[model samples]
Target: MGVALRDIIADCKETLDLDALKGVAAIDAHNALYQFLSIIRQPDGTPLMNAEGQVTSHLTGILFRTANFVEKGIKPVYIFDGTPPTFKQETLDQRREVRTRAGNAWKEALAVGDIAEAYKQASASARVDAYVIETAQELLGLLGIPWVQAPSEGEAQAAHMAGKGSVQFAVSQDYDSLLFGSPVLVRNLTVSGRRRVRGRTITVSPERIVLANLLDYLGVSREELIEIALLTGTDYHPGVRGVGAKTALKLVRNGEFESTVAEKLPDFDPASIREFFLAPPVTDDYNLSWSAPDTDGVVAMLSGRFDFSPERVEGALEKLSVKAKQQTLDQWF
Candidate 1:
């Protein structure tokens, strides 16, 4: 999970139509995969699986969602996380525990025929395992979508690419991309559409956040914004108890971040976290070339191997073909 800075940074977000987002975007692959695993499921929250009991929800998501991106003139380059920072081990362990509990809760809810509760619990139980990652990369190749293996955090690598102008922006639902100094961050790109929330159907649209505008609106430097995130907790460190985003912002603005950390979290060093965000581990050794989708390969994998409907797969490929023909490879970059 990313830092909870949405509450304070809401004003800096700009709602955008799909037509306006025509450019190269570095997508956080794991984040998008998690969204797929969570959202693309049966009524009872059972994920789509093939004959061998392998999960196909992510494949469906990659095929259709990436097609939609291409149809909308967006070139997406996926970035996968390699190794996480050592400081993030606790967070990883905590996430595993949460998923385990949620998985048990999902089974219990399904046993009791509580579809809604099962769905909720199943979403929380979504996991991105090695099999999921490997298959996702395979399908992406068939779709002619490039993917990079980041040396560390995927979001940080995406931010690094965006900062270097290798891509127009970083696409992720998490606000941590901003903390990582991505000049621009696009949210809700993967799951944007009509969504149900609390029994009410709502439309979710893509929103863009520019780092400079956010800093200007908050009247604090990027460093201060990161400090705000630290006070409200991050994946690396549990923040001070009872400090929310607004309170953290105030504390940072009033120049009390160091003093407050000293008083509340005397043993923790904020500098380490700060340094990680400021200069996270990243690599420049990656290719970002878009090419024609391997139609037969895609069909063979999705339909022949997996149990996806051949007709639906063909339709999705048609979308990719129509858009790919309209824009050349040079136009994408």
Candidate 2:
């Protein structure tokens, strides 16, 4: 559907005319690192390092985005993925394989002095260190946002908070929140004012979608819908060969999967799947509460350690201060 979480934010910004965000809590997908920093070893044994002798994008994005959202006045709650579902491992392995092939292609392009292709391929080759979920947690502490390391996806943590009436909505660019059965998943929670991407000025108008309503229109149970999604594909499984939303639903509705396929379900592995739905359980890991924005924490993490500009960090603080004042004024009115 190309229906990204960021798309939701863009649409919300366009349609709802949302004010500087006042109440809703925002959640980050991972550590918000910008680039890959680990190591890439070749077949014979060679290492890849930038001119600076290290990787930084993945770490940098964490600092940048935390400041980014705080400035926009959204209270961010950073969540990191912990132990994952067993089925997810196959997806991760495939991603590395693709990156390896792409990296080789890029390396070949670079060797030939093809500047564009070199830059592209150089980008393709470094695939080792993108996993920076830990940095996200650390940065969250620094930015003063409460963070939860969930046993699984960050969206699941965000969804649980919203479902239990703790915060307002789960915010991210991923559509999987709906699959996780979030009460509300606010998409595009990160778009800022539009700017030129290439020669053209790209306008970004972020928006939110009521997943409950979307589910209603789609006309399948949420469990089956997500399962169908899994069968079709996800960020976790891009283009899973045998399935898609419609087909998955058809299979779920049919209720005749072989025992081998049925064995993969999380619910099925549990002694009883009904217990999961019956209680609407909230995982115990997440915590959501605060005195105000953790301004000092934000500054310390970004400006102090990662070299984020002070002005950028302060800009976020200013927005949170404004939101706090607005609430105070509204109380009088």
Candidate 3:
């Protein structure tokens, strides 16, 4: 919800209270680590270190954070990426090209004495591959949490499982899950809202928005919803030049949805649109199992090889314990 990471993290502690993170099976963004590192290389003053020599701060940051969540008693099941959707490859390609161009622009900014642009580009580059699947796998291994190597976006696989009655819910910052038909999605997961309410600091529990409710608001079926997102432009696909979210929603609501979109698409083919919704971009060999998080294995992999922070790992498990007990008590009462 918030922009800056620092502000977001601060809000999480102030509002939702990290202490309350419990029993929730967190689906970690496996692709974010490599993403951040690819964007930000060490500055000129800092000579480049070999892969093995560099402290690998990116991995450490993720490991430390995930471990902390574990300590809070939330059972994190770190899902790793497999292959991406065929339809998404084009989008991925476009994003990578943009990053490459930005790198060039950053150099120019530095030459032209625009430190602000240079810094901004540096920050953007740092965001690339910050959550690489392999990194998450290594980190989760150390913390005793379970890890799932999905065949696509970790969240998509997680959402699919949740919607299909496999998991309780899917947790992620991305709202795209709604299009993927995930019934439940909780936002501000690692962030919180700040409400200064007088003498006592009252932290609100994290809020959630289910897709079903969103559907009710939009007055569209899940299939129609996906169609709606496609028209508006999603991460996976580029939408029409002029069409936007609200406009797309209006068209959907108006009538003869496909024909309406075709009218807008100077060259829109009903067949193409139909195929997109009939079988959206997804993996083939995706599998979902209700295997519990492997606490010991996760801990061993992270701690032994990745040198992950043990304290954070303990913190997530602690949260889980308290939540489990509370659930038990509530059931009895």
Top lDDT model: 1
Question: What lDDT does candidate 2 reach at residue 198?
Answer: 31
Best by TM-score: 1
User: Residue 60 in candidate 1 has what lDDT?
Assistant: 90
lDDT of 1 at 130: 98
Candidate 1: stretches off by over 4 Å: 190-192
The lDDT per prediction is 0.92, 0.53, 0.53
Worst 10 residues of 2 by lDDT: 36-45
lDDT (tens digit, per residue) of candidate 3 on 135-162: 5555555444565666666666667666
RMSD of each: 1.2, 6.9, 7.6
User: What lDDT would candidate 1 get against the real structure?
Assistant: 0.92
Model 2, C-alpha of 171: deviation from truth (Å): 2.3
Candidate 1: residue 322 Cα off by (Å): 2.0
- The per-residue C-alpha lDDT of model 1 at residue 129 equals 99
> Ranking under lDDT, best-scoring first?
1, 2, 3
lDDT digits (tens) for residues 107-220 of candidate 1: 999999999999999999999999999999999999999999999999999999999999999999899989999999999885357887877989988999999999999999
TM-score for predicted model 3 compared with the true structure: 0.67
For residues 1-333, write the lDDT of model 2, one tens digit per residue.
221323222332324433545455646454233132222223222333234434445545455555555555566666666665554577677767877886787667757766555554554444434334555556556455677666665666667767767667776656666666667766545454454443256765545666666656556666655555555555544433545455555666686333424654434332222223223334775556433557787677656666667797677666655555565544311
